[model samples]
Target chain A: MKDTKRQTWMGLLARADAGRVPELLGQAGPSPDFEWLRAPEIGSVMVQGRTGGTGAPFNLGEMTVTRCTLRLSSGEVGHACLKGRRKGDAEAAAVVDALMQTPAETLMRSKVLGPLAEDAARARHCRAAKAAATKVDFFTMVRGED
Target chain B: MYVAVKGGERAIENAHAWLAEERRGDTDVAELDIQQIREQLSLAVNRVMAEGSLHDPDLAALAIKQARGDLIEAIFLIRAYRTTLPRFGTTKPVETAEMACDRRISATFKDVPGGQVLGPTFDYTHRLLDFKLAAEGEPVTAEQRDADPAPVPHVTEFLNRESLIEEAPRDDTPPPDLTREPLELPAARALRLQALSRADEGFTLSMAYSTQRGYARNHAFVGELRVGTVPVEMEIPELGFAVEIGEITLTECETVNQFKGSRTEPPQFTRGYGLVFGHSERKAISMALVDRALRWEELGEDNSGAPAQDAEFVLYHADNIQASGFLEHIKLPHYVDFQSELELVRKMRREANAQTREAAE
Candidate 1:
């Protein structure tokens, strides 16, 4: 897959619902042999922040994130880092990532990435519409001037 | 001649067992569920999340339940749990300007953009007690209205446009984390705010109140007090673009205080800022006041020897966990020291009596 395509899918996987990842991988079926370079492990990552959007960096806080690494039979390496403690999601994401680097790239994109992207877009749209329903516009009347 | 009291281990064990039984009192009544605490006593959960320096409501609720409604103890439990968690990459500083405000009000200006939205607040409620609420109460349905989509311009910005308020210079330096590093003396404003954010609410509130009572009075007007949710984003190194990681609810406050002018500088309104996790307006406002009081040095004003203006004193005593631990440690064994003191006093008294008798003879 192209770098842009890989980036898109990786972004989708990062934000993807953990439960949905397993269902998508199940539909994609089993892939060629692969070895886990790093099995899915639940841990945390230090969250840092700037003073403002443009200011100097500061340690904001920490958040729980899961990560995994694997290598496919075709010699392509894949890694996944996702928010929260969903081990299965990280594993499935890593497998799909590795598969994306091989001949099965097209198949993986269609089966896993495509559906997840659509779902994500739909969720965003729903939230936007809900927020819009409450949008208000305030206007002031111009007072008489001498 | 005092012998060491033994069997403390068994006594401690028995005491703990009895305490556990007391905690579960009246099994006949339905036990308070964590969910009930999370939903019904949400303010307590918010306090725990704020002072605990963690945002997980469920864990806060669980901590509250475990601590038996002692908010400070719950905060301690959450803080302890927080230390064990791993550090993820930092998010970009949350943009409060873009917050979807549920409550936004300005005391300085009666009419401002994003017209005063008095979201959910207890400010207007009468202090009278409602006997009905003592039992199971009916859910309240609030009247909903469309919120203004236009970004609410801060009240201070209006003053800034005319050079009335002091310009807050933009600095890009990273702030120090009190949780990760030991707090040093003469803290920066950023570090001071971080300490105040999680400091004991009562201590901060009282300190702030002292400033209002003329200890180091800086006449303040609430420029803006807002409660809302702000999206948190993080720059992904590989992607080279920040992505929305999550959103968190926050209470933010900004106060405009009396300006100080000297030969070198023109008089301009100074600002005090406070931001904290969850809807903790009291904590946020108190934090802002204390923050301003502590800014005496930077603002080039003389410190009037106020407790709130004393940075070291405020920071030292603000941590409830530390204060409680030191305060309660007196209950531990002190018999050895007491016995030594007793012997010394007796010897001094005997010597004094002998000296007095010699003088009489």
Candidate 2:
């Protein structure tokens, strides 16, 4: 798998709305029989920030994340690490990740990642639009010089 | 000198039970749910997350609910919960430049790349309480415009391009984690920043306010203040590439402070920066001011014996959890210590009386 392409799908899976991945995964088809290489575990990752926004990096804080790894019956490995404490989301995401590498990739991408990506884009647009409404544009030649 | 004191297990248990009942409050009243707190009292949740050094809205909301809306107590709850979770790894430094900004403003420059966005501000609102809100209120709505896909560059970048502001060099050295190690004073910039990031908002605000009143004033202009969500990405060894784990809302303030420059350099502007969890412009601004004040020595400016300029004074007293814990600990039984003090006072009085009587005879 290409790193950037896999990163895109993985990011989409990780940031997917809780339980949305599981529901989307079901619609794709029955998940290939898989065994847990690593069971779902709840943990945290320290978020880092740069010193002057672009300067030396520093530790800011931590946020909760859950992770799981699995292997398909035919032997392809998959891993899912995401934010928050949704075990089901982790399991479903890992399965999708594994399937994405196999011959079933096309079906999974269209049925699962496609809708998630679209919803995410819509949300991004909505937030940006709301923000755009508040932008200030200053008028020139309204002052003493004029 | 510490003695193990006797019983109160039963009373303690009863008191805890009583506290639980009191926390529930008025069975007749509809109890406020976690979701309500998370949504409606969002700023409070944001404050707890900022100071608690944890970023989980649901947990912060639950903490707020359990703490009866006492933000410091809520922060304490979140801090305690944070200790239990195993650490996975640290993330790549989040790029605030890529933030999908909800609010972006600059006091110094009216026209910036992002423009001045006042997103959901209370700045121009009349403070008079609306009577309609006292009763059942209707859902509020606002006008929306198509978002401009134009780039919203950082205002500091403009200063940097002109070489007007002092350079902030890239450093990748592992910064000291205050959670794991004790804070040693004469702390580095990174350590000080980590402490300030989770420092009590009210304390930081007061310290910043002092500087404005001329206690080591660092003539600061709000170069830019932006509120937005930024993606947090981490490298998973298994995947071999960084992935976006989540997005968190942050309020970032960058202040450009006037500098006469140090011995080695000519006159240039200095930078004071603050980034905090959630949409808290007040906290972000205050943090920027205090951050500048603490840079007195590094900036080659005289401290003038101000509290805000003293790193030890500001950092040590800035944590609400540590401050409250030590203060509240006094309420616990100190029978032995008190008894010893009482005995010494009596002995001194007795000696004084005997000495006076003998001298008179």
Candidate 3:
């Protein structure tokens, strides 16, 4: 619902520019050929691949990626680069960039970052709840007085 | 009263000194010199160069020393250093056909033009431990013959003549440098081969092994494996043409893969290629097999849904440094997330207890 186009544009630019989100904003234009930076989240890949450790093969490596740049009307730029895919991700990233830099930062935060952070928090809480449920408290009433 | 942590900087400085002391070990013990590490631990140097994507033996030696012999850490050090150094310029592609080979072999053909030369290899040597190496010893040098002047052409060139192998058209387009750019999925053959060459040897080997063991199986035969020094040329903007910048040791592999002919296509052997830094034949051969498997889609073969055939999957997760860094980062502070979870669980538990009590009553 927020203007994701602006925020995602910034992210796409940053992704294109080697994860460096730019400070100066200008007219966004078509990306050059050499923009994507391929940095994969390997820990997750390893964990996912390890689901059937005996069956799955895991590689410890990196890739060569390209990214694109776009500017929004709010004079903000966005960039994003992703792994294991092509520049088709650039369009979605451009929209997210457009929204991230708008007055809708709060809305975007609630709609996007907040949910992800909360889900992460919930996962941690579930682990803690499981651990805490195992806790034992011993109590004994005095026998003599009555 | 508890004191404020005013000496944080000093504490850091002292901790670094103590760490350095620990790294150096006892003062009485003979120090491991950089040259000693470079010469004695040459395989470590090759790995650092391969993974670091740099060719400086001295720098690799220094990184190995700094990293306390942890090869992966040494590679990380080398890579970080490589990133900081100013790029004077990139070299023109090395001419593989003009290589002065120290070692060359062909599994596809026993007798090929230029004759198969196994110049230096440990392939046939027995693995029995030799106790004579325990003490300082000098190896007897084999008599040297004056090497031939003519450049040995590549074995693939012969296959290209008859069109037995797929046409690997030479392109002048500049290939992407993986270090300078992030990796993307669905990479071209050039990009995939580039990543695999510098990928971790063990990782590359296992991935290649997996393909052979039926995962995205692409039957591959080593067309050729050659190790030698090749001239590296770079074009000077001032000169307007390319000139030899230097020469570097490289291991190049070409695999002849079974090409399943399509209705529109003819039956011909396809190629899987790998070229890597140093005398690393095993790494290069493995890389070639994986490279061919990754080419299934481009070649119009049926998508086997195998791991090796998935270029997106293979290229995205091949670097050990990236893998290790992310894997180790879980050790960093996450107490903030932990605290939030703590509150949520406490609230949930209290509400659950109340509901249970009410239900019992």
Q: What is the TM-score of chain B alone in each candidate?
A: 0.94, 0.96, 0.90
The TM-scores of chain A alone, one per candidate, are 0.88, 0.93, 0.37
lDDT of 1 by residue, A27-87 (tens): 8887567898888876655444333222344443445567778888789887777766678
Task: Give lDDT tens digits, candidate 1, residues B1-361.
Answer: 6477777898889999998788788899789998899888988998897788777677889999889889998998988887877665666677777777777888888777666777677887897898889888888745544333445666777888899887665566677888778999978777777778788899999999999999999987888988876666656565466655445678888889997775666898888877777889998889889988998888888889999899999999998888988998888778898889999999999999999999999
Question: How far off is residue B281 in model 3, in Å?
Answer: 1.9
Rank order (by DockQ, best first): 2, 1, 3
Looking at model 1 chain B, report the run of 10 residues with the lowest lDDT sum.
B141-150
As a TM-score, model 1 comes out at 0.80
lDDT per residue, candidate 2, B21-79, as tens digits?
89999999999999899999899989999999988899999999999888999999999
TM-score on alpha carbons, each prediction: 0.80, 0.96, 0.67
Runs in model 1 with CA error above 4 Å? Answer: A1-146, B1-6, B148-151, B237-241, B352-361
- Those runs of model 3 whose alpha carbons end farther than 4 Å from true positions after fitting are A1-146, B1-15, B348-361
Task: For candidate 1, give the docking quality class from DockQ.
Answer: incorrect
Candidate 2 vs candidate 3, lDDT winner: 2
Best by lDDT: 2
Q: Which structure among the candidates has the greatest TM-score? A: 2
User: What TM-score describes the B chain of model 1?
Assistant: 0.94
Tell me how each candidate scores on DockQ against the true complex.
0.21, 0.73, 0.01
